[model samples]
Structures are given as structure tokens and as C-alpha cells.
Target: MQHESASAMAGHARQHYQETEQEHISRSQSGFPDFEKDMPSLVNRFSFSLKDNLSSYLGSKNPFYSNVDPQKDYVWLLDNTAYQNRIGRWKAEIVAAYFVKNSGKDLSEVVGYIADKIGMAKDEKVEETIEQRIQPLLDSILPAHAVTIDLQGVDVRLGPSGRDGISTDEIAIPGHGYKDDQVITSQAVKADATTMRTHFASPKGWAVLSDIDDTIKKTLTASPIGILKTTFADEPEPIRGMPELYKHIVQKLDSPPFFYLSASPYNLYPFLRDFRETYYPSGTMILRDASWMNLAGFLSNLTQGTEAYKVDRIEKVHTWFPKRKFICIGDSTQTDPESYGEIYRRHPKWIGAIFIRKVTGVAEMDESTKNDPERFKKAFDDVPRNVWHVFEDPNELYTKVDALVQTAT
Candidate 1:
């Protein structure tokens, strides 16, 4: 029954992808003047279309080509966590992007859409300025192709940004005696870019892999209107008792490295990073790489193929730190159960514990399935029953986390 349901869902997703791609191509041809100019060649368009379709099918997004004026564009450096390689050397994965700023008209249209979606009155005044609230959404990405970034004081020059306006480089740290969890602040030598890199020594210690949306921060993913309101208009709110609980986990496990895993697109990096720094432990944020051109993609990002997306990322993390036990934290609002369960099955020893927040009070969610014990049981089939937990209150996990730590020791 579950297999059939999954197959049906996958088919629906593929159908939706085809429809959306056609819509996007139509919009580009009719509306976007720049898109046609940038993708002038039929061959180029075909190639990009092929890649884009393939990426979407694989539950990811490919970076499209864009003409960007360097004078008008800026770079965003994303924070990353560093790990020591098997060769006993430190390495960091740096991800940066080049983007042209959106115009006031663009911002206004987005704000209007968000307002209309959430049924906000035109005269309503939010606590913060509209610009401040919508800052993360204002980037028009440019393919700052082949632009090198110099990591100041580290003697590492990161290789060029790809056609997606983003560059991801894994470079070895030159120094030998850096402390575990020591933060290195790197600045781009030429561009006005700065980002932090947190180093984790190669040690067989406990680490955390936490979901964002409803796990720590309250993002009402189940409700479309709720998602728009909370994401664009309202201040981000942390789930009650989660901050302290994370702090307890950190202290109990001697400050294990944290990975904030989310299906949210990378555009929300700065916004989510600020929320994490203010409330939770500092760790690497693993966000989806897709940059969407419209508002609808935001909701799609939070809802689509999240199980496979998360499983892929967790496998990458496992490759990095196979010896480190992980405590996976997520909410029932999405596919956390299935994703975590799959990861646990693949690497039973690598996962120390799994906690799924049994989210409630969201009227839009299908509570019957989301809160079903049989669903969880099926998701976590063949795994030890004690290894995975579903709880309503964050407070309930305090003792469980402590017990896990004690058992690990």
C-alpha cells in the first residue's frame, strides 16, 4: 500500500514538473526580455532545457545562464562547516554566489503577491520595513562564471563561480594546529564578501542533524498562507522549548557539530542563518541549491521530494563523518520520518537517535497520516524501536537525549 502511494506521488510530482517547466518556458519566451537575449542560441536553449528538466526530475535545480553586469552585481558568501580529511588536514567547503539586485518594482510585485496570499490589508503596518522583511528575496542571480575568490589570510583562492552564479569549493586548510570547532572568518580579497567557516576535528563524537521549518523555527509548511505570512511578513518564531533543548544536547554531548538540514531553497540562507544564530547552535546549514524565479517555487521547495533530497544530503554527511554518531531532529510536517529512517537503515551505526516532532495545531496538515503510528512504524521498518521517537512536546526529549549521551559514553 505504501509503495503504491509513493509511486502515485512520484508520478504526480513528475506531471507537475512537466507542467511547471512548460509554464516557465512560456513565461521566458513571452515576458522575460533578458532571458531570450541571454539564451540566444537555440542549441544553448535546448541544452539548458535538457539540463533543467533532468535536474527537476532528480529533485534538484540547475543554474541557468544569465547576463550580469559586474558593476551592479554583488556576491553572497554562505557560511560552511569544515572537517579534517583522512590525510589529517583541515578542509572547508565554501559556497558563494553572484547576484544582481532586484529593482523596486520587482520587490513591490513580490510583496504584493505575499500580501495577497496572506490576505494582508494594504494599510497594515508590519513591525519592520518591507524592504528589511523581503531582503532575502531581492536577488536576481547572474552567472558570474569563472570568477575567482581569494580567501584572505588562508592562502586559498577559491575557483570560479559556475553558470548558476554560485561557487562551491573544497579546499584544504593550511594550518595544522587549529582547535576543534574553531571558527575561521574568511573575506573575499576583491569583492565585498565575508563568511564564517566552523572547523570540526576528526573525532568520533556525537553530532546533530536538525531540520529547520518546524523543528526549531516555526515555519508553517503545511499551510500555504501560513507559510507565506510567516516567511515574508512575520518575524521568525522558534518552537517553544526547542532552543533550550538544543542547548542541553550541545552541553550533554560536549558541543557536537550541528547541521541545519532543510528543503528550503538557498535564497533563504541569510534569513534562516540569522534565525539560527539568534536561537540555536552555530553549524553548517544544508539548504537546497535551486533558485526559483517565482513565488510559487518557494512553497514547492518546502514540499516536494523532500525525502529523497534529505536522504541524498545525509549520505554526503555520512561520507564526511562516518565515525561520528548523529542525532537527527525533524518534524512530522514533511518527510522527516521517511528520510531519517532511510538514512538510519543505510547507516545504522552512524545514527545514534532520531526525533520527529509530532506537529499539531496546523489545520492544513493531514493529521491522520502525519501523526499515525503505523506510518512511522512502516517508515522505520526493521530498525530498533527505541532508536526513533515521535513526540509532541520538545521537553519530552530532554531525558531521551541525555540517555543517548550516557549510553554513548
Candidate 2:
């Protein structure tokens, strides 16, 4: 029975991973230049045969891999980069699958191991060590950027609702009432884009609100149980350039963009803190609620709640930054695109631009997502404009963000 449960868990996990890949791919606007028409041929060129053998190592334990006694010499095999690479690649594949599946638990330390071993993310400590080494050197040369300037204080505040018209429950869902061409702009969107400004005493300040699962870091292996399993195994791979991306934002922030970390729930703040301490190293976080889970069972029976939670968060964001311009980053694996689109529609004035990491899968709309697809579509369709900026890799986003910052400056 134990083995059966574990096997069942593995199957569920694999499906989730594949779905994540699909959803991520779907939201992507660009990749491989002209490869879309030839995706089948392209995929055929990869070593997919590896999956048959890879599956066993990913889930089953061997005496060799379990032989380790200490945390420091955490090598699965001594002096065998090939074995390490194979394991890393396999782990990366599974974790990436997990991200889309949302199958895992919350074992931070183990997740950290899979993340590091698989190169899911760079060691957070490395960034701190480098910063400590480089701070004095950069401080000495700071005058090169401008006149003698001392980095001073920074403050950020989340604003409240500007104009309250309809009550939260006043919003209506589709099919149940409204027409095919029906619109709910009255209750959902602001009269115009909400206006919020991130004022800087200096020349530039920038903020980034990144998605947690697959964007900045990888806990993508899903399942709270899988997360628990991999906790002691290996570190998940970090999407390449994450550290540099955060660093660039930090460098730009000397002009002091009032940064705010906004995400779907308050629980995700620790991941953001990990980002800050390791890479950006400084910023403020605008926390949001995850209370939707409390109503998950109830909401799953109805379509109203999907948009309700997202709408609630956006309204909170607008209230907090009534006049601040901020950059938004989230994945397509969840409600990010629609959420950002609605925010852009209501307060086009406040949102500078949105960068959505397209992690693929419309789980919300999938039968497997445990929600009403029709309801999900209605909420998505109601958004004023498509606010998604999809990219295949972190590097693509870094290039675009560089341009946005330059233009903003």
C-alpha cells in the first residue's frame, strides 16, 4: 500500500510536470525564431530516450546515492561529473515538471538541496560573499557614475483604494447572467488606470515583483510531499541569469526606485527575502493574502472565486500604490497574466509594464485544475488588454528589462 501510494504520487507528479511545460510553452510569445512550425522536429532532436531510465533514479533510491553521511561533502558520487550532470539534468527535468504540477510540499532545506545540486539556483551564500568582497571596491569607485553621492534612506508604502463604487460581492460572473458580449468593467476595472509613482530623489529607481515557483527560483518539483523528499536530495536549478537580473535591478536602484515585493500570498515572502539577501540585497515587499485556499473547497464548486481572489489582490495593490509606476513579473502557470491584465486595465497609469514568465498550463481551466474553465475564461476575457509579456528564458526577459529601465531613466 505504501509503495502503491508512492507510485500513484509519482504518476500524478509526472502529469503535473508535463502540464507545466505545456502551459509555460503556450504563454510564450517568442522562441527559436522560426521553430514553432518545426517544434516536433526540434523536440525529436533532443534526448527524450533518457526519460525511461531517468525516472527510476529520480524516484527510486539506490544504496550508492544514499551512502552520504555528512551535509558538507554532499556529493552523490566522488569525482564523477558525468554522473553529477546526469543527475542534475534529470532532477532539473522533474523539478520543472513539479513547478507546473504544484504537487510538492514545503521542506525548505531539501528544496534548497535539489535546487543547488541541479543548478536550479545558485547558492544564496555566494552572492553574500561576493557582495561583502565587492562593496568596499564599488564604494570607492561610486563617483565614476556621478558626483560624490552617498546611498541614503528609502521608503515604500502600499496604497489604499482611490474610489470605491461597487461592493466586492457586487461583481457578476458569466453565462449565469450576462450576454455573450457582456462586460463587467463597472465593478472590476478602475475608471482609468490607477496612478502610482515610485519617486526617486536620484535619477533612477526600479522594482521587480517576480513569480516564486519557476521564475526566480525553482521549487517546481511540485507536491508538498515531493518537496519534502527532495529537501535532503539536491538543489533545484535556478533559471540562468537570475542573480544578474536582480543585480542589474539593484544597480539601477541607486537612483533609488522604491521597490515593493508583491505576490499572491504573504507566505511567499521568504523566497523573496532569499532573492533580496542573495541578489538584489535590498527592497521592500508588499504582502498580499492567500486566504483563497481557505475557500478552495467552496470556491471549487463555483466559478466566482478564481477572479475574486485575483481582483481582491489587485485592488489591494492599487490602494497601496495609488501613484507609483512599477514593473510586474509573474508566470503563466497561474492567474498572473489575467491578474496583471486586469490591473493594467483598471490602472494603466500605474503599471509601467508587465513581464510574465510563461510557465505553461492553464491548470485553472484544465479539468485537473479543479475549477470551472468557463468561469476562468470569462474572468480572463474581461481584462481590458492582454498584459502578458511572455519569454522562453530568463535571459530574454533580462534583455527587455534592460531596455525598459533605460527608457524609464
- Worst lDDT run of 10 residues, candidate 1, spans 38-47
Local distance difference test, each candidate? 0.68, 0.34
Write the residue-wise lDDT of candidate 2 on 217-317 in tens digits: 55443332233223223343555666676666556534233333343233333444455446443444444322121112111111122333455655654
Best by TM-score: 1
- Predicted structure 2, TM vs. truth: 0.39
Model 2 residue 179 CA deviation in Å? 52
